[model samples]
Target chain A: MTSSNNTDTRLMTGNEACAEAALVAGMRFFAGYPITPSSEIAEVLARKLPSSGGVFIQMEDEIGSIAAIIGASLAGVKAMTATSGPGFSLMQENIGYAAMTEVPVVIVNVQRGGPSTGLPTLPSQSDVMQARWGTHGDHPVIAVVPSTVYETFVWTIKAFNFSEQYRVPVIVLLDEIIAHINEKITIPAHDELAIIDRTLSSQPPESYLPYKNTPSGVPLFAGFGTGYRYHVTGLCHDETGFPSSNARIVEELYLRLNRKIDQHRNDIIEYQTLDLDDAEICIVAYGSSARSAQRAVRIARQDGIKVGLFKPFVLWPFPGEELAELTRKAKTIIVPEMNLGQIAHEVSCATRKDVVSVNRVDGTLITPQEIVKRIYDVQV
Target chain B: MSFRYEIRLSGSGGQGLILAGKILAEAAAIYDNKNATQSQSYGPEARGGSSRSEVIISDEEIDYPKAVNIDFLLCFTQEACDKYCVDIKEKGILLVDSDYVTKVPEGKFTVHKVPITTIAEKQAGKSLVANIVALGIITGLTGIVSKKAVESAVLSRVPKGTEDLNTKAFNLGIDLARELK
Candidate 1:
């Protein structure tokens, strides 16, 4: 039924939206073992995907889960896997391989307090840096941090698009708070949403260089069984799918797989600016914590304290340059994260402004009051 | 110019606060045609710690889905009640499991002395259904939703095998809550 007004909604969690986005993005396969805060995605997909003519498999472990999604993607299907911290760590090896082999796969890391299973239910945005450097060796990654369930829905589609277009693993960085937070969300009809198809290998089976570069810097990917017989390997290869040790070839080839996402930073970056045009203070946050910070901005505004919020939806590429520029205008900058100054360090580098961190390690969202208090505390 | 209302249900994890909020939000959104959202805490160690679900319902598109000023508060443990009592909005409704909670100080809200566990055990003959009874009571007290919505939502939600027992527990809750109202 159509909503009475545009505001009508049905209650849903961030995990549910991730699953719905995958389905709406034309994801046909899922392979994941349930993990805390992120388990519901696999569970819901298990029940929902089969009915939608998709395949869902609970793999032996996170590694296998990611491996299966890679295979599924090669077989001409959009695929994804979900995990929390420990599981995220386990899948890193495969995630690196997805980057190397240029497989279009999306990984959902619903972060909890972690070094190793530190707090399973507690929320933490510590994975902000992990999404970038956690995969090992130079790799350009596309990761999106959603502030709300609605943004979660939209970013999931964007994540899949980047994975398919750039031919690499894209991370949808979620946390315990957003992953499990249920909210009323409206899902636009299938026609209203955009679905991305992978850049297929059009070369004849024998003539295919799976790594052939296009003008846009992304090599055309060969979905398996498309009559394009080619080899795929973890080893740095030449313009071909074959393993190559040529120093120049490996350097250039490895650089481009990353450059394909890096160079298109414009298309790769997704962020939101709230009250940024005129504000004396700025709060930088992502995921569920950003939602609370937005409220803090409104509260601060009501108190005649001019404040703005900068939420980098694209967590990895991190609008560092953007923040550097914002630091020029905004007098005080406060970064509130579920972790102790994870993304703040990046903000510190990007902006010359004295970045103040309002850390929350209690496994709960950093409240608006705490943010407001931090904003004023810095000035006073 | 609509106010976004976020109701947080806090208690030790596995106390069914998450599912209770889910049922409440579902009843409000699906049954009553209102916008609602709920989120819970998760961790390997969260089972015995304070866990909460926050639901936001509004007549307009909810720009922020997190709770700000609480309209209803439910706590099953002393810590939860102690943690949230001060922040509850004026004239808000507070439902505490009186058996587990003792020495509750009066607040600016309406405090109900519902022995939810006792009612569930005595009436429905199962403690698991205490949440359902609480649901029925809240629905009746608020008058914002019809019992049919919750009934349909719960029936649509219960696992395949245990549907009948859940319905019985729900009806018992409705009766109890209606009597209180």
Candidate 2:
């Protein structure tokens, strides 16, 4: 599965890797605004996409950027957009629109410090919740966070796959650190990658229901100008693709949208674990924090501290079951994140245990020494 | 060999030190089969602002990407040397560009002064290749990465038609470092 025709290793930033992976994943349309820490993704695609016959358009603003991608996705092309904190905030309404319409699109949010324009050049994992709930409504969300440049490439491909698979907009959450840092990665051949396209309705135009319910709860999507004249809107709609004000129809529409992802949680959830077999203390982290936690776990094990690490790459549809099973045997759980205990609260509720949160919102990374010191304190 | 070797290249933003750091890291990781990570910090200004790039090459996977205990520091400007000298590990190797950086701050690290800008201008006919010259000197002085590997990485990154000039500058840097020893 890992085999490739062209295995040349190149040094690239995480943002560059994301752009390259999107192209490899059959993304032919890119619409984005230039934002610090995330603008490189757009810059690279701007130069590279044209040579590959892909269209790269820098929209007027972030809102237009996301809206353009949604429109392109509806036209039967894999599309994406990239932005930072402030830009991400502006794209939320369009993101929610994509969610309600079940348009398959990928959004790359290279996160920075924020409630509003806090720090543009610095890194922070503060947008984890925003990624899950930034958009309005109760629609299901799928967001993948990558810690390394290599994983950034791999997960960007997965982001497109998941979006097309579940008919939802997928978010790739990147902090400023990983988005800007350069590292070596071996890019596999095009033939070696598992590229997925959206499933099209096989039924004729007369019987083609754009929002027809299925066993998987994921409706078959038909592109515009493809002989399927179906209405698409952000409003709640029935199975026939028309807006329905009926309470029962609206309830079923929302429930099916949520169930489409919930029922397929096993396929969407991805995580990494280390030394949890006989450990008494566990450090749960994600994004760039997971890198430091890996070092902390290694150092703690060398000192016989019985500490381990649980890193969730898929932040949304939160891996509650996996965390629950890992935390059941551990005595103490420590969560370290860039924001002030954003994901820590989720860990506590999932495990039904006391979780110690080591948070840093000062735009500096939490070091391994800080996590190690906290582990020693918990031991006492 | 040590488990990890951290290198820092500091200078003005236009000195191309960030590209130098990337080449060094790629040489170690792609050619030498070591794990490496490269990161940079610069001010808002594109040029003339203080800039520094760090590369950490390790035998194992890099946990924290940033360099904490720098084993080698190459400073092309006085301000960069003064601002980042304290972060170098005690008894580490510090290389400076003698043409631009006149004053060498007193530190526990061993200092080697070389006219990198002059060498690039006089010998390579272009000062833009000074960063590549510094890469050659660092690889020659410390032997952290193979000369063949650095050359391959350099040729891969340098612009299409400037390979001959960059290679000449790199070789001259290696010769100068050898003479200093």
Candidate 3:
């Protein structure tokens, strides 16, 4: 994949790649605030979207940014918004609103350090827990973390696809490192891309239900002003999309929302394992931390240590089963992240093993040497 | 084992070090068919603050993007030179702009001092092309990327109207390095 066309191999930043891939994935509307590390995505879209017959709007704030994208998605356009930690925090309510309303919107959080604007220009994977739980309620979450600029491009497309197919909000979690780093990526040809657009209702406007449950547990979408008159609310709603307080109907709605993603885990979940076959030590990581872990694994292997890496691109689905299975032969597991043991807890729970948590909350990325030191510490 | 070459372009903002890093990385990755990763870190200040762009070129996939063992280091300011010179590997090349980066620190790496900004001003007609000149010198001195690849990458990245100026600056840099050798 190259700069403009599919055949040309060009140098691009992770933000640029994400923006370009969103266009390829049929994103026609972008609404975002200019945040450091993530602003480039919005800037690129602003320059290219209008030329490509798409819409780009710089909202007043992050809250307005996400709300605008949600509104665009409801209007039958594939929409996305990019922001950093502070902005991601502001969009939490709207993210929940989209999830409850079953609106297929892509929200990208290019994570920075902090509980509250800790570091604006630096990278940190501290938002792992926030991405899964920040939106409030027990709604199922589909979040992807891309470790490379190429993966950022690839998974941004997948995020849109997952959102459209399941009628839910999908989050692409990128830290400052992956978002700003420049890499050589080839943009695949349009035909080579697999874009899953929202499934529209074939039923007449009177017969159509915006949130009707089917065998897949995914409801058909009917865009507003598309002759489909249906209620949409964030409250617990039944298949008819209207607010319903009845216990059974509300419970069923929540169950289906969870089941649609959980039952189809095999299809929605994506992960990668490296040199785990005969290894005695395993490193679990994702996003930019995965890059450091990968290098640590290589260095450890060269030092005659049996070490491997388990990287999850699909973070929300967690891929616990796969990690547990892959690390069955390993004697110890190591979970390294930018946060202080956010995903490490998940690894311990999944594998029923005590994991060596190598964490850094500082603005800088965790170095490979730092991870290698942890691997050696746990190796004994 | 595959070979990995790391390069760090360090200077204040407006030096175009980041763009030079990108062009060098693109030359290796796109044209040379090698794998490359370029990452940058800068201060909040728009200009005069410390800015550093690092590129890693490897025959294999780049597991980590940041440069740990720098093979080539280009410094446009004394602060960047002093801060980053320690990270260069033994016997690595350290290129500095003699105009701004005075008092070069003694290190294990080989030092090549040149009046980069002055040359860019005199030959390229502006100091803005110093990054391009530095790219040429880096390419010529290390031969990490082919001259043809660097030229193509530079032409593709520079603004349309300034291609001739950038080319002149790049060639001057290459010739300067050749004379140094």
* Candidate 2 Cα RMSD (Å): 2.5
lDDT of 2 by residue, A268-302 (tens): 99999999988899999999999999988988888
> Which docking category, incorrect, acceptable, medium or high, applies to candidate 2?
acceptable
For candidate 3, the C-alpha RMSD (Å) to the true structure equals 1.6
Candidate 3 DockQ score? 0.60
> Which CAPRI tier for candidate 3?
medium
**By TM-score: ranked, best first:** 3, 2, 1
List candidate 3 segments past 4 Å from native: A1-6
Kindly indicate the candidate among 2 and 3 with the higher DockQ: 3
Provide the lDDT at A131 for model 3: 90
Q: What value of lDDT does candidate 3 attain over all alpha carbons? A: 0.90
In model 3, the clashing pairs are A1-A186, A1-A187, A2-A8, A2-A186, A2-A187
Number of clashes recorded per candidate = 9, 0, 5
State the lDDT of candidate 2 residue by residue for B90-112, as single tens digits.
98989999998899999899999
Superposed on all Cα atoms, the candidates' RMSDs to the truth, in angstroms, are: 3.0, 2.5, 1.6
- How do the predictions measure up, each by TM-score? 0.91, 0.95, 0.97
Ten consecutive residues with minimal summed lDDT in candidate 1 chain B? B38-47
Q: Of the native A-B interface contacts, what share survives in model 3? A: 0.71
